[model samples]
Target: MIDPEELGRALRATLAGFKVPRNIEIVDDLPRDDNGKIAKHRIRAHYADAGARTA
Candidate 1:
């Protein structure tokens, strides 16, 4: 299984060009719809709320 923590750490380590967002949440599995499609909007909302809370 892919370790989310390790994945996040690696991403943060190698992400040199882009400005990584402050609240980088490493979810085990991304939110999905009934059809198994990834719910990007929900993920965006989740991070938005998380950013708000941290702010």
Candidate 2:
């Protein structure tokens, strides 16, 4: 399995310091829309619910 931190490290090495993501979520598959496109809004909504539902 790939370590997200190691991958983040590699990314940090290649990208500008400001471009690194603060948190890297390792989901089995990213949510997609009916048309099979990446759903950015869906991802955000899922993350947004992480704490709310837990709380």
Stretches > 4 Å off in candidate 2: 51-55
- Sequence-dependent TM-score of model 2: 0.67
- Candidate 1: residue pairs that collide: none
The sequence of per-residue lDDT tens digits that candidate 2 reaches over residues 1-55 is 7799998999999999899998776778888899999999988887789969988
Looking at candidate 2, the ten consecutive residues that score lowest on lDDT are 22-31
Best by lDDT: 2
**Backbone collision count in every prediction?**
0, 0
How well is each residue in 1-55 modelled by candidate 1, as lDDT tens digits? Answer: 6666676678788886365554355557888999999999998897799889989
